[model samples]
Target: MTDVRSELVADPVGEPREVAPTTRDVTGLDELVVRCTACPRLVAWREEVARVKRAAFRAETYWGRPVPGFGPPDAALAVVGLAPAAHGANRTGRMFTGDRSGDVLYRAMYDVGLASQPAVTGPGDGMRLHGARITAPVRCAPPANKPTPAERDTCRPWMARELALLRPTLRVVLALGGFGWQAVLPVLDEEVWQVPRPRPKFGHRAHAVLPATDGGPDLHLLGSYHVSQQNTFTGKLTPAMLREVLHQAKDLAGLS
Candidate 1:
């Protein structure tokens, strides 16, 4: 695993209060995100969870820091999630890994040909995604899986930069929940696409299209219920339902 500190760059001047503008390429930005401690609450909670490892993972080392987006830079689709899970990404160092939520998501993606594996045990587990990238609105795991509005706003610049870097090839965005749906709108506005005057509401299969700037291309946005236990366990979101959404997104993105 890479050392987050060793990959850090000196703090740049005139950057936003919390989220810094990306001065390097996507790879550099990934490293930069893992080193961020913009929100004191998130930093404290993530570290606390790592230090007090769950009984099952007591013998395992935790990533503890911010989890960066994963997948190819040229991906045509992006799956945006909420914050990391305390015992999940906060422990595994990869978003949507080492948890039930990730289990459901990866399985669906793999079935739809977006992922090479149906499960990811850790960062180096050799699981990969094709034509799609996985990321979150907030990089760090928040307390009780919830981040305050101020924390979300403070962390906006990173998501903004990540989306900007992916803009060239990105054609579709799959927001896993309302939180992610809301998070992406403003970020997209700052990038190549602009949200409508009255934002589209989030719902299962909710769809919206924003024409690219200067007649570049049209971007599609879709929504789905988060793959949390609350949704999956209660049948609010099922495997078939999720797979349907993913298949549609893959087709829309024109992935083979």
Candidate 2:
């Protein structure tokens, strides 16, 4: 993967901008993410979606850019998702905000005492997370909510950097969906956590214990079905099920 700074930053209209790479701080990474235009298809699609606004949000401005991870920087737990929804995080500039998926996810976290509020309507809704953080494998809102393999690979370095920043304090990772499960393994491996041979398959409540290494803390990986409408509406994943997984994570992370 290339350095995040080498990746081109897209202008609002999908044009590349002239900018230097930044330092590896939470603030710098946040700025770098919104500026990323590394994937041409993602850049064009995200900009188009923003331009042709959703009817419900026509009067509002769209973020139409990469959505940065949100939560405590030194959190003990990290909840990862596939990517931003076209009308969710892309519209609100916060991961999982302004969507049914987020509504379900945050509510479950709140039930497990990880979140302060059950509803996450937007970035300014006063929603707060304690002891846990939420992020995604991909930052941009891909067309039809699916990012290509190339795009996923291209976007991996950002997630890698994110996990590296969180490695010191991060004790457990809750991966939502198979995409997030697959996405997190490589990042964990790069951080020197000993992943088992013949990798663990993703399933509801799938578990893997990555032992501590090189002074880094031991890491716990847990899997759950995504909070997408397709899954929730069809009853593939329910609130109680999601809350149970979060409760397990909270206990393992030693969060009250």
Candidate 3:
């Protein structure tokens, strides 16, 4: 099978500290993640979300702006989630921003020493991350927070481009849920991933050892149930479980 959506890897560039603010690294999906207007329906939904949430939580105004992938400028670990949460990253622009999901993620990141701050309100909230980054399969907010398969496919290339930037040092990836892993696995080396498991079943804490390709870095990809309210409130994903995953990630990256 085709690997990691190879179509866009042709002209992949070096990991630059400064990407164009208005445009993403490439003119492909990465670029589109920042400027895409294909899903008008979701855009409208995001706007409404921002408006109401902004009014209610005036102090914590929703980001409601273009959600940008985040991490230390040169992080090695990239955590991929399904999509932006409506009141979270979709509004705040930063992955996992503005809501409970982010609260859990940032807390976990902090507990395991990955986050610069314990909570994320928006991009300007003065928080930062180290040795790790976070992104999603889709950049835009989807209706009812679900991206259609075509939408996810359209957004995959940008993620690939982002992954390309970490090139030599991207030692590990933590896929938040099944979809996030499925979207990313193909573009990477097969040996990097453990054999695929049945779909719809999330493998929390599982890990795959990936050898470098084309002289790229070796990688360790781990799995985690998304720390969404669904998982957290239901007690499927706990703070300790999430922290343990981060601890594994740090160990894998030799970050300690």
Candidate 4:
């Protein structure tokens, strides 16, 4: 069998922090993201997980590289999550794919007409997001689903550039989990909107509207508990609750 890691493209010349700012569009930024090897720890962990096959996925080849955002370039709404999952996105090469958390997230998105399918089994599963994109603060799946502060900082530039490129039509951002909410504030403040003093706190259904630095329409920021198993299995984040937030975000984004 061929080594999956060998099939991955060599890392680009510069680091993510340096290259991300120079990227002009989402496509270029995504290409850089997939080629990133900036975080040594994350690189080792993701590749390690991909090698040590999960029992159910033992026969499958894993996509150990960083996963890029999923959806259209001109999406009006964006969903931000903490990071890719080790057994999930790390294996499938798509955010929120092949996991229980994704099961809940895509279902809610589909219910609100943001997704073409209700669930994703893997990449090329015919799933599509309509007028909405899903991304994360960290592209690679971190160990124990927790990325170190350093890793998060190193990965921030990619998302910063993504939001900057999306600023033309992107209106509302739905952040899943407190980590994602906190991580996105600086991206908004530095790239497009001027975040308020004593930055907005995060909670399920919490909302904040940030005025644009360039005098454009305001961007709405919405928060929700992550669709992790701990939250969903415990009913902390229910289907009804998630759909409600999606509906409000869609309205704010003017995506009917």
Query: Could you list the CA RMSD of all candidates, in the order they appear?
Result: 3.8, 3.9, 7.4, 3.1
**Between candidates 1 and 2, the lDDT winner:** 1
Return the lDDT, model 1, position 29: 78
TM-score of 4: 0.96
Question: lDDT of candidate 3?
Answer: 0.70
Candidate 3 or 4, higher TM-score?
4
Which should have the higher lDDT, number 2 or number 4?
A: 4
Measured with C-alpha atoms, the lDDT of residue 128 in candidate 2 is 94
Q: What lDDT score is found at residue 41 in candidate 3?
A: 55
lDDT of 3 by residue, 1-256 (tens): 1122122123323221223223334334243455444444555666677767745576665655446688664687889988888767766677887779889999999888888878777767888888888887777678787888877765565676677666656788889988887877865533333334443234998787766656655678789988889999999999999999999998898787
Model 3 spans > 4 angstroms off: 1-32, 51-55, 58-62, 189-202
Give the lDDT of residue 178 in candidate 1: 96
TM-score of each: 0.92, 0.91, 0.79, 0.96
Query: In model 1, what is the error at residue 3, expressed in angstroms?
Result: 21
Best by lDDT: 4
lDDT of 1 by residue, 1-256 (tens): 1122322224422223334564456787787787776677787788888889899999998888888898998889999999999999989988899999999999999999999998889878899999999999898889988999988987888888877788778899999999999999988887778788799999999999987885677899999999999999999999999999999899889996
Estimate, for each residue in 1-256, the C-alpha lDDT of model 4 and write its tens digit. 1122323547443577788889888998888889887787788888889989699999999999999999999999999999999999999999999889999999999999999988789877899899999999999999899999988998999898998899999999999999999999998998869898889999999999999979888999999999999999999999999999999999999998
